[model samples]
Target: EDYRAKGFFKEALVNFVALLGWNAGDDREFYYLNELAEKFELERVNKAGAVFDIEKLNWLNAEHLRAKDPADLIEPLKAELNSAGIDFSGRSDEYLKSVIIAMRERVSFVKEYIEKSPYFFLPVAQYDETSKLKNWKPETGPQMLRLKEEFAKLGENPSKEEYEVALKLVATELNIGAGKLIHPLRLAVSGMPAGPGVYDILVILGKEETINRIEKAVSIL
Candidate 1:
């Protein structure tokens, strides 16, 4: 015998299980339990075996996760962060929600979302060496130093638009593609070659922290 077990939202589980051997006689694939109870009919159920599909289950889970209210999503996320020893004393509910909003589309499970996003809670301890070598050029140090200066002029917590404008202005003045600076700056802030948008990460990290990370990256180069 083969056995498998996992967790799911009650409503998603009910909705998923109800579909295994039944059809609603329409193309819709999602419904609330109450909606299912309202529409379910014994005559509509297929007599054939229904193989449980984990991929379909995960898709349903992602849909339900996206539909969740941010307030509803926050407490459990906080608990998971706490359990992982991530400090939340300085981070606000709004800040946490911003992270959840940014991440919800990219994750199927709450824990998976939290586990993959340590950069949200911790500073970039070290830059990725490969990215550093690839993106951090001889002239990149001066360009990043210029980025720090431009961002410092924005005071704390510049808007995303403001961050973009600053980086573009610097890139234009330096006569280089915005990507040249963008990739290295991402490595500076998150120590990764890739993740979220650079301006999104910069705005969330705030001006001082972003500038400081860039300075560190410049020193390393």
Candidate 2:
């Protein structure tokens, strides 16, 4: 229960502990509880001591997290959010699910969906210092203003593709690579150097919030 509270899935914990001093006489490491029951053999138990590998447990937990349906993660993720004192009252389940889908592969634990990407729930508190040094430049301010205009043209609820096109058009007019706008824009919206695709972040944030974040970044940075 404590492990579950801490975001380690029960199945993953079971799978990891099972491999401590035993193997199924093969390379396969993942198994369902039922499968473990069927495969366990007294003969395969090792005489040698087992080393507790926290890294392996983390890996297995991530694998299990990815294997489950994103919808199935919502309740537990909400629990984690509540425990963390994040108020998600206004956010819908479907919206939460989209966040899960976007961040699932990038995170190893349920809490990380919130930890690594708090911008989804709250406004950008602080820009990543490294990202500011690397992605934000003298020209980035004006470039972001122009990009904000393009995003404003998108109105509310623009698709990810539309956001991409808007960004590309800005890059073309500026006679710079798309990466120039992409990196700084990512910094503006996510306040981080990396995570999910920037366009996806834009769409998820919607038009008003995206523009507001850009405006905020411009003023602050």
Candidate 3:
């Protein structure tokens, strides 16, 4: 129960424990429950005591998560989000699917989707201190305000490329590298040092939300 709460799927847990005392005589580490039933052999059991390796279980859990379709993860993820008191109201299943696609590789557990990137479900409560120091600058407020104007120019349902082009135009107009705007923009929207591509985050958040977060950052940070 504890492991499931921590995002270990039942299949992953069963697969990991099965290998602790036996092998199928190959390099394969992943197996479905049915596969395990077919492959288990008495002669393959190890003579030495098996160690409970939590790290290996974590890896297997991640593998299982990656193997699943993003849509398949939505209900379980929603349950976890509700348990954690995350309000995903007004967000669609497609929106959640985009988040899963973006964050799946970055997280090993289901709960980590909300834990590592709370900005997805809620507004930026606090900015990352280290990110603020590195990405936000004294002149960043005015620069972000200018960037916000460019974002405001975008139509509804803008593409990732549109966001990228807008940022590049802002950088060119300021006579600075895009990184100047990119780093600060990422800090403004995600409140994290890193995650997915900045443009991807912008696209997922949509034009209004993206511009709003920038305005908030400019005012506060």
Query: lDDT for each of the candidates?
Result: 0.82, 0.92, 0.91
Worst 10 residues of 3 by lDDT: 2-11
lDDT digits (tens) for residues 11-94 of candidate 2 = 999998889988999999988788999999989988898999889989999999999899999998898889889999999999
Model 3: which residue pairs collide?
A: none
CA shift of 115, model 2, Å: 1.2
Residue pairs with backbone overlap in model 2: none
Q: Write the per-residue lDDT of candidate 1 for residues 1-221, one digit (tens) a residue.
A: 12112436666777788889998999887887778999999999999999999888888877888888977888878877887788889989998888888778877777765656667788777777899889988888998999888888995669999999999999999899999989999998888887678788887777888888888878876
Q: Could you give the candidate ranking by TM-score, starting with the highest?
A: 3, 2, 1
Candidate 2 global TM-score: 0.95
Cα lDDT for residue 194, candidate 1: 71
- Candidate 1 wrong stretches, greater than 4 Å: 1-7
lDDT of 3 by residue, 123-152 (tens): 988999998998888999999999999989
